[model samples]
Target chain A: MIAENVAFGIIAAAMALGALGVVRTKNVVHAALYLVVVLAGGAAQFILLGQEFVAWVQVLVYIGAVIVLFLFGIMLTRAPMHPKDSLDNDLRWPAAVTALFLVGILVGLLVHTFHADKIHLNGPVRTADITNDIFTTYIIPFEVVGVLLLGALIGAVVLARKD
Target chain B: MLLNEFLILAAFLFCTGVYGVLARKHAVLVLMSVELMLAGVNINFVAFGAFHNDRIGQVFALFVLTIAAAEVGIGLAIVLLIYRNLHSADLDDVDTMKG
Candidate 1:
């Protein structure tokens, strides 16, 4: 239990710091790299929660595919590698105030809702059970997600192709 | 770790993403921020799913992941298109639709 707590603390700290980097960094490439750190920290949190399959999927999809695509977008668009003052708009102060307010409300609500609850990590939901549920109970949504992905692919090709 | 801890962490991440979305001028960075927000939601889903010992949260998380992937693809494609036409990825510069 102590080990789990320690792991959670460490992962949470990394995630917070990495997210700070993502937003604060001026270079787009640095922001993308920071995003990778945040994404990896998220996967670590999933592993600590004992959802192994989801953890691996998080690593594979977010770290492997998504961030790579972000990097591709960054490079292809020729975002400036050096720090630039123009990376942010004039609404930084307002944005910061709004974000802090949202965070306060969300954290307060979560604490009020689940303050006494403790999640037992021993009884993890297995991959097989998840697959069964997805195939049987959520089959329609699953197929719809498949179609959505196909459409996204075709749309991307069409939108990105040079005329 | 208590459930509140995870919830608080997710909340922090979500707020960070929100700030990024509202403040960043680069369109790709906004997309990255969106990814951060989705990651926070995924954490919440997995945490609740683990808490109840149910498979639904993880299943839903998978669906979220799929949708996020598709979103990034289409979003970045749009970003690329904007860049190709305007030669700029800054969100504020793409005001051609303004009245």
Candidate 2:
């Protein structure tokens, strides 16, 4: 559908621009903020594909927790809000060229994968089915992830605090 | 939405993150770049999950989300401790850890 393609384009453009800001920003906090935008755009793309579970998780976990932790660490460290030290743009040319080349190869591969005949093709997605599968087959790994988070929390606290 | 569009976005995100990691002098920004890359990987997971009509990619993305959260928690804490000792966040200034 025209609507889906357009939505996809808008989201993809936002994702790319946010990512560019992450690379172009001088302020570390600004970079973290740009990453939040990028993460949100990616989550939007996930939602556009009808994967509500993944999209919500992306919003909840990455934007909510990780970036907040990074900000806290930056604040706690007394890092210069905007020090005199210049942000390095030394490899800008080479890196940009590399990124462009990578994009070209990826687009080429996409074209190869989806021929013109498949333009209007689509399949089904069901939230109920995915939920059932997660609660059934993925129960153990899901529980383990919780335990892993606990371990990580304890370890991080131990490593971060000093006597 | 098809998988290829998601793949393209993921690829673009990854390349940008690579560029950021290489270009950023601030250690915190470098960590942000790493998170950008992880977000790309998460997109890939959900994309595949949708295409195959399976929920495993969601599970995988969940796992990745957890790992990324843990990574940032530990990484930032370490950065804070380093800044406490060194009084600077510029990567070039943290040579004490190298030698």
Candidate 3:
């Protein structure tokens, strides 16, 4: 239990700092790299919670595919690699305040509601079980997501194509 | 592990994403922030799924991941179009709809 607590603490701290870097960094490319840290930390968090499949999927999809897409987008857009003052606008302080307020409300409500609860993390959910649940109970949503992906693919191609 | 820890971490991540979305002037960065927010939600789903001993939560997170991928694809496409037209990826510059 103590080990779990410590592991969670280290990973969560890393994720928190990465999240901050993503928002606060002036270099757009560095922001993408920071996002990698946060996503990797998320995978570790999933592993700690005994969800290995989700963790790997996170690594494969988020770290592998999504970050690559972001880098491509950055390259195509030709955003400055060097730090610039125009990354943020006039609402920085207001945005920070709003975020802080949101965090306060969420943390307070969560603490109040689930202060006494504990997670067993005793065993990982079988991948077979997740697959079965998806095919049986979540069949419709699964199909819908497939269709959505196809639509997004076509839409992206059409939207990005030259006239 | 206490459930509150996971939930609190998720909330913090979500709010930080919110800050990025509101403060970032670049469209691509804004989309990245949205991904951050989705990741936070994904953690919540996985944590609760683990807590309840249900596989459905993991399934839900999977769906969220799929949707996030689709969103990024479509969003980046749109951003590319905007950049092509305006030669800038900054969100503050794309105000053609301002009446």
Going through the candidates in the order shown, the clash numbers are 0, 0, 0
What's the lDDT for residue A99 in model 2? 72
- lDDT by residue for model 3 (A1-163), tens: 9999999999999999999999999899999999999999999999999898889999999999999999999999999887455699899999999999999999999999999899987687788888888899999999999999999999999999999
lDDT tens per residue, model 2, A98-154? 777877887788678763422232444566777787689988988888888888888
Identify the runs in model 2 with alpha carbons over 4 angstroms from their true place.
A89-101, A114-128, B97-99
* lDDT digits (tens) for residues B1-99 of candidate 2: 566777778877887787777777777888888988898888888877777766788778878988888788778777777777788766777776585
In order of TM-score, best first, we have: 3, 1, 2
Tell me, per candidate, how large a share of the native contacts it keeps.
0.92, 0.64, 0.89
Q: Can you write out model 3's per-residue Cα lDDT over B40-94, one digit (the tens) per residue?
A: 9999999999999888789999999999999999999999999999999999998
RMSD of each: 1.0, 2.6, 0.8
Q: Which regions of candidate 1 deviate over 4 angstroms? A: none
Better of 1 and 2 by TM-score: 1
Which prediction has the highest DockQ against the true structure? 3
Candidate 2 global CA lDDT score: 0.78
> What's the residue-level lDDT of A136 in candidate 1?
97
